[model samples]
Target chain A: MSWLWGAVIFWLAAWAFNVWLANRPVARSRAVQLFIPALFGVTLLILWEGIVRGLDVPGVILPAPSAIWATIRASLPVLAGDFVQTILKGALSGYLIGCGAAVLTAIAIDRSPFLQRGLLPIGNFVAALPIVGIAPILVMWFGFDWQSKAAVVVVMVFFPVLVNTVAGLAASERMQRDLMATWGASYWQTLVKLRLPAAMPFIFNGLKIATTLALIGAIVAEFFGSPTRGMGFRISTAVGQLSLDMVWAEIAVAALAGSAFYGVVALIEKGVTFWHPSQRGRT
Target chain B: MKDTAGIATPVIEAKGMGLTFETNDGPVHALKDVNLTVGKGEFVSFIGPSGCGKTTFLRAIAALEHPTEGTLTVNGMTPDAARQARAYGYVFQAAGLYPWRTIAGNIRLPLEIMGFSRDEQEERVERVLALVDLDGFGRKFPWQLSGGMQQRASIARALAFDADILLMDEPFGALDEIVRDRLNEEVLKLWARTEKTIGFVTHSIPEAVYLSTRIVVMSPRPGRITDVIESPLPKDRPLDIRDSPEFIAIAHRVREGLRAGHGDEV
Candidate 1:
């Protein structure tokens, strides 16, 4: 009871301090900008730790943040292996292949009205298929390894990038196209110089969306069948063994990896599209 | 060889030209029975109200639009063939500069497409940037510049290729009055320097009178030319030339021609 009350008091005090800090002129500074979110995260951890200990909750159901942290530290090597197997080998490779193929297909189909009409609907249908339905089939075809997981990820990411890139290729204005025509620009030249650059904003939108899907597909597909070493495999086994801390640790890793993936793409987007109105006027 | 006499060969020629757009509302006559000739080194203006097909005519010359009836030619070849030959540079109502590129890069775009050498591309970009008085703004993105400056950058882009014909469709229409006036002055100077055959479209009577050696007055509703007035204004025009009697007379005749077109509609 004292632990619960102590947590409540601390939460209110921290909340008040954050509000005061937010109102201060220094809040706009870069250090304070970073500090506020870090502080809020710490406060949540503290509250979770206090509440779990105070309630004396069973570890099999829910582990404390500290327990999860401890498990993460203890299983560093295992976690690193899982990270490499699932994220790096499966998700990253699929993302590169899927995005590359989609962009190429978009350009190829752009010249043909027949293919654009025929292919886009097929892509949409593929995108709509249930992941569970396809995962096991892919696992059988590709065998029980990271390859199957990558195949699932490729299926999940292809449609968005294809649709976005096609839409992006058509994004150049009619006047701009007319100017190209006046200059007697070859179709290849126009595609390389104008259409490709114009399509970048839309392509990045698709790419950013694909990063999250890539990770989720890779992890979830591992559930159908994996080589007994991925994050998904570890998570399932740990759950069956009633080590909730290990499951929480994997969740933490997934969350961090997902965020870092998204952040890197968004940073690249900012760099590539610095001239865009949405990206301009920042420090 | 085509010039049997001393008469300068016409750069653009149209005879009984008509363009009809097939829309859901049935065929709309955008241009009809339009006959005009723009000679080499001539500055011609097409002026009228909205839907008068002034822009349509310009687009036809650029081969961006095709005439359903009659003939149109640029430099003695078909408009399409002339476009293929890269005989002209076109400027739109808006600047239409690529947002991702700097001003200099935008100017270099046509040069790159036309397969100019690296040294030549750099040289032409510099020349046009200076010609449009946007010299120091070469590295700035389109959005970083003022609207007037962006329009000038676009002009520089059109000038970079040094095409013999410059087709402008109300290029300064979106700008404010003061910017428009300043741009008008600069355009005259540019025309003087380059001596390119120019076809300018505008809605303003003063703009037509000030810029053109000939003004083609047009009207809407099965858009056709109402009158064609030859300007007697000398080649060397100062800003104050607008106050002169000759300038006002040409402006008044253009106004009357426009009003007569409207009078027929009413």
Candidate 2:
């Protein structure tokens, strides 16, 4: 059979197996339920691996998972160095700055009507400004270091968090406010006791959304200009050298890190704003 | 408790109280010329049709709202002053329990806000929870309990501060008759024990007559009070009081007053 025929047979068999497994009743244990998705993921990798080799496709078009894993194994120190430089130094710092600025801005916007009218338009403008444009400017301003990557992340993440938090602050209904009023609560007391607590779910939403944006910004901004140690720089250089497996390894690291960051924010959100319906949907 | 008929001074008095709002269409007169008085420790039930300002009148007294034009006094002070002094506790139509907190936590909220010590909050929360006959459901979330239990938790929240007055807006109107009757009896018992002046708003005629020392009948659409009938019931009312002829008579008078208030020109 031709390589395309072989690929088709494997794909069909895998699809049939997945459908059969999905039809069975859910497992009694939480571990088993989690394992099902992992099983499917491994099967997908196997299918991808079989098809790529069977077709005699060039490495540039698609590298097999084993080749990617082998590249990761061969370059652990390089991968670790990039992970530390891009994620810890660049993304984490940017996430803190961007989310911090957004929250302070949101609190200010929530406090004064004047800022809400003046600043939200500016945020909308910032949100519209593409990272492709800002990354180069940030690189120029902050120099070709992790600082520049962090600056790029600040630009990418500031708006979504601000807007969501502003909306959350406005979410307290009339009766709730009236309850505070009847208690003769002072402005600071009302804000600290009621509005801030009420606004938490929205604030965390912005934080969670900003995590991925921070990662993307840190990685993409590095592509504009950076020392040779970062993920974006490595991936670009690897691509130039036709080492496609290295690019895949870097991408895997990014996916894992981004998901972990997002998960942490979501977990904190569950703790802080457990009252919200979005949190209720988790159970 | 004294009958307090034609007392020398009213514990609460509202004179020419009115509230108006300007909508896009025109002015909306929500309340107009609402005059009322309650003697010390009186249980005044405000009975009216929906949209009547029974709840609004209660809110105005609680200072949750400001009447456009009125001179009002509760405990011989302005509504704002009274609210600052923690003169009254209010139970809203909805239980309005915070979803984040457990039942005991919800009960402790008012005490916490009022700057009571932690020990005081715990003590009062326990006392009020038992007062509402919820002895052991403290750790449960609001969603875990039925609607009646949630409302009881809210009532416990309102009562935790030991306010001299209780403002209840349709507090038991949501419950089934069986639960309503049980709660009604419990309220009377609490009133007897504490002598708290309760201003209750409800649409149920029997509920109004069964628990109140007075019934303030209200009208809607530019809401105003139509009548204030004194209840003939003694201070120590019980569950069986609902079957009394005196309760029926007061309910009849409240119904008549409600009808008379409706369709009356401003």
Candidate 3:
């Protein structure tokens, strides 16, 4: 078809342009660096739109990026309410409580050797339980509100942070500890000065992993039951009604929001653990 | 027990020390009835074979490991009491610099722990950095520096607090021969300036002979002292000293003693 021919020509042109751009001479300016990537992403989007329209794909199966954008513009009020309810209220609160409690638990476990032996197994087991399995039970227990969603998130996030912190606390070298011992440093002094700072990279690793988890938990928990305002509820209900365009719009929002949340945590992690080798930029 | 008030008395004196670790093969005696004394402002080196108790003995002195059957005192006080009194500094095999900290900041750790005033901490950091020849590299992280530089920083840290005793455990074991020679001279200069009592542990024969006033060579199984050699080298040393017949003789003697203790095992 003429449409297929046009799409292929455009794709080939974009590919050639990408290859040219990547192999360009060093004398190229900085603006080209930004422009090249933007050009590729836009080309991909345009190709997607062209193919879907050319094939006459059902809206339920696929929505063009422009169609998704129009739907999002029309439903800003609904989407904003969901974002507020799910992310700001539920996910944020759950994240703080869960991470704080894990850190405190890690300290306690580090103190009592008996607790470390007995409790770490339970914490690891708890971490392995699926969010899908727990969401319904938590909704039943916390009674189908934002409270249940937060509880699910807390369950989802608690162990990774705790285990990573405990492992980090133990990661300081023997010489470092011996130096403290020779200095006549008290147990508290050594922990405060050496072990805690050494544990920072691991703690940030756990925090970054937990960020995406917090988002996932908040959204999934809404599927079991909620006040019909959260993201999970809208997504599930829109799918049932075959409002594919609305679903695509909500997905676009979730992807952007989730990415933004993850990016912020990663930036904070870079600031906190700049000494870590993993954070060093080779390029 | 050593005397209570005389500054000339031995700063650290151990009477009949013993250490035994219970293993799957049964009790392994790591140290046994080892008696030694380190006097004020003396430089002593503990040299021995791999399994010998030189490190164990020093750990006992630091109160890091307890001796099972003897009393040890530092400056007429218990090891724990002496540590609390901040009587000594220790440098381990690695530089033990915190990777997160800058070179100057790692040197400042002890001062920070003791709550030194901000101005005093800065002055001390500046002084020690220069003393170690690491001036103007204050803000560079530990990982950014080479091994020799990091070890120099570690030495600077031990000297920063003006503590009168230093225990260094194979501090230059990882460096090349050239760097080790330089560090050995620098450490001697530091000792002369500060007049600190130093107890060093090493496995190298030439190293022991070069820097030590007295070298205590030890043997392994149920680890015990084999020989104690007093060096005849003058206080002021020259690079050409290594080529001197006197240095070679002492080094050969140490190697023989090490072989006497170690080679018979297999």
The local distance difference test score of each candidate is 0.92, 0.84, 0.86
Better of 1 and 3 by lDDT: 1
lDDT for position B184 in model 1: 98
Over 4 Å off in model 1, which ranges? B1-7
Worst 10 residues of 3 chain A by lDDT: A274-283
Positional deviation of B132 in candidate 3, in angstroms?
Answer: 1.5
For B1-266, candidate 1 gives per-residue lDDT tens digits of: 12223338888988899999999999999999988877899898999999999999999999999999999999999999998888999999999999999999999999999889999999999999999999889999999899999999999999998889999999999999999999999999999999999999999999999999889999998899989888899999998999999999999999999999988665
Over B54-113, each residue of candidate 3 has an lDDT whose tens digit, in order, gives: 998888888888877888888899888888888888888889899889999898888888
Q: Each model's TM-score?
A: 0.97, 0.94, 0.94
What DockQ does each prediction reach against the true complex?
0.87, 0.57, 0.75
Ranking by TM-score: 1, 3, 2
Q: How does chain B of model 2 score on TM-score?
A: 0.93
lDDT of 2 by residue, A14-121 (tens): 667767766777554577677767767876787787778877778899998889999899999999999999999999998899888988898898789999899999
TM-score between model 3 and native: 0.94
Model 1 lDDT, residue A183, Cα: 95
Candidate with more favorable, higher DockQ: 1 or 3: 1
iRMSD per model? 0.7, 1.5, 1.0
RMSD from true fold, candidate 1: 2.1
Would candidate 1 be rated incorrect, acceptable, medium or high by CAPRI criteria?
high
